[model samples]
Target: MNQAIDAIRTFNRFFTRHVGAIDARFLDTDANLPEARLLFEIARLGPVLANVLQAELGLDRGYLSRMIARFEERGWVARDRLDSDARARPIRLTQAGQAAFEEIDGRQRDAVAHDLESLSATERDDLVQALTRARLLLDRQAPDAFTIRDARVGEVSQVAARQSVLYAESHSWGHGLEVVEAETTAAFLRNSDAERERCWVADLGGVMAGAVFLTDEGEGTARLRLLHVEPFARRRGIGDALVAGCLDFAREKGYRQVVLWTHTVLEAARRIYARNGFECIDTQVHHTFGEPVQGETWRVLL
Candidate 1:
């Protein structure tokens, strides 16, 4: 209890000192924190809709409207309607707002620098290590779990749509480039209850960004299909996590061999597969999107 109390006190002191307490002089009352933060957010992600800000920031609509009005009055922001839908307005920072945001951002960084300078290098490293350990513990203690239900009902449509776009763009294929139909994918998800096939979706913050599926071809062989991570979720280790989940499930189902088919052009996927014990076992030359391409087959022993 005493140790915990000490830690809490340390955290409070750190927060107060670094994040500006009532008596803090670094950030004067030139503007309220909310307005300053709003300015920064607008400058960082301008041309973003007000609805998006409200959702992302959990701000009340009335409050957001008031802030936006203030920004507009100051000539710091401009609102424009979408070309396709004039009713939908997006807010963007004007030149004046951008300049103000840069000034505020510089000040914020300087404040952080001041706080960091007060700590010795070893102390800073120690603080970082502690924070990292705490973060990992929190993540493991409450792993962000997505509903592991049958994907075919409605969610598979989402996976198919995004996956189709990814493949179309990367392969330069136009129109009707979706490799798998929704009906087929839905059937696969629906039939996977017995582990004869499986599709797993990793919902990060309520969005399906990572997925891996398995299809049993019978005769002791299983195929890993549709292993993909959405572009926004890349580099977050979601892809690896999804693959690991799929492999664990496949192994538990007594699969002897697992195979995956992917284009050789996708170096990131290939690297991930290789790191996860998949070896390229076959390759075929084919024409896709008016260009010659090589498709590689990778296999792993369960």
Candidate 2:
């Protein structure tokens, strides 16, 4: 553990120096790294609460307040009282702030591009993969780092393929399961109602770590399907987040109940479903996926 700690500290020091993080002016801008980061955060998360920002950045409350005061003095940001909570004020970037953030972002991008230009394409790819793995390992220790969002175009197919591959490797399932996944995904895409059907991908950092889908099952019922978490991303609350997001979306769409089907052998998924208030409604042995397996249907009333 001590050796690991020393190694991490060494890397932190090297990375800070390599990125010119110790420089007073970041990307040749008037704002330092912290200030520039604050501006970027403000731009990314519009109208963010100051307290939230302070907590996220791990800045002292007074230091953050002073920084905001400086931004306000420079006409770069504004704070407005929340109507729902008058005592709480949210900070937002001004026109000048947005322009400044853009400049800083462009410069930072250029700097990164310049640094990567020295590496071959394959080397760059390896670097990216290594970084992704590092982030996944680190983020697994930080529960709040995971985010659930709508899956982007072309990602649904990828999710389906990943699920098929993972299941085949983990459970000795054959191509039948893959065929079923493909057909279901295709049908969902072809016949889904945008207002009723939704799919969410859990992202750890920039990687798609898990996915879940909710589709209309008629009679005000929503079916949860294609739920999966990558092997490297398990035990980090990602499955729970995906399931919860599905149930929340179902509730919002006026679903009277949400249902799911899973194999009894998938104990982790079963635990997730049960923890989310789903009750086992039925179980039957089936030789549908190349083997005799007990398929269980679970439901939760919203």
Candidate 3:
């Protein structure tokens, strides 16, 4: 625990340094980091509101008011008057504010692009996945930022690899798990019926953090397979959302029932299945994932 705390602290310090947060002027601009971010938000989300900005930035009401006042004093923003609720005016950027935002945003983009130029393609991809994973763990903020979509070409392996690594880390699942995951994923891609069978990936800011597969089991039954979410990306409805996607697809394909197999060790996933109206219909002690385990079969009538 101490080691983990120290590692997180070290990374926090490193990130602040990397972003030049120690500087008085952010991006060498007139405003500091918080003020600069507020400026960007106003320009992007304007005609935006103070309360919305306040909540997004996690700033105290008084602090955000002062910041907005400062921007208004500088002629960077103007609040449009509200007729009914005079106290709740929306803010918008003036030409001056627009210029300021463009300057700061352009500089920041250029700086990040310059930094990325130093890394190889593989390293860049790894860095992005790592950063998004960290943010998801810290804020649990992936629900809105994620979109469910059909798995793209070559993503079958990606899904399998992510699921395999996550399960191995969280449950100490053995090598056979990866082998099975890879096999099933490849088979899905190779033989799945586009209308009756499908796999969806929860794309979190371009990273595949969760996946579920719906496959025809003959006679109006669809089986959900390989429902998994990265540990850092769990508990934010990604798992449930994946399952929902599976059930929705199953229904649309005219399937009468959906079934899934899961282990008793996966309580989180069990809840997801149950929440989706699936009932545990059978259980058995099986030697799988390198150990004896209570496996469950759940089904939902559509």
Give the number of the best model, judged by TM-score. Answer: 3
Question: Which ranges in model 3 have alpha carbons more than 4 Å from their true place?
Answer: 44-55, 59-95, 116-127, 141-145, 168-172, 186-196, 216-221, 235-237, 251-257, 275-277, 300-302
Q: Sort by lDDT, best first: what order?
A: 2, 3, 1
* lDDT (10s digit) by residue, model 2, range 78-180: 8889778898888999999999999999999999999899999978866876788677677665553779999888778988799889998999887889898
lDDT of each: 0.74, 0.88, 0.87
For TM-score, candidate 1 versus 2, the one ahead is: 2
Please write out the lDDT profile of model 3 over residues 1-302, one tens digit for every residue: 99999999999899899998878888899888888889988887888878899887899999999999999999999999788888878999999999888988998999999999999998999899888777777876445467899987777778888888888888898787888898998898789889798888888877787888899989999999998887666666888889888888888888999998898889888988989999999999876577888889999999
Candidate 2's displacement at residue 298, Å, is 0.6
Off by over 4 Å in 2: 1-111, 115-130, 134-144
User: In candidate 3, residue 210 scores what lDDT?
Assistant: 82
Residue-pair clashes per candidate, as listed?
A: 0, 0, 0
RMSD (CA, Å), each prediction: 19.3, 9.4, 4.1
114-229 in candidate 1: lDDT tens per residue? 87799998788667656544554445543444443345346666777777787777776544446444554777756755546777786654446567778887777888888788
Distance from true location, Cα of 252 in model 3, Å: 4.9
In model 2, the Cα lDDT at residue 276 comes to 93
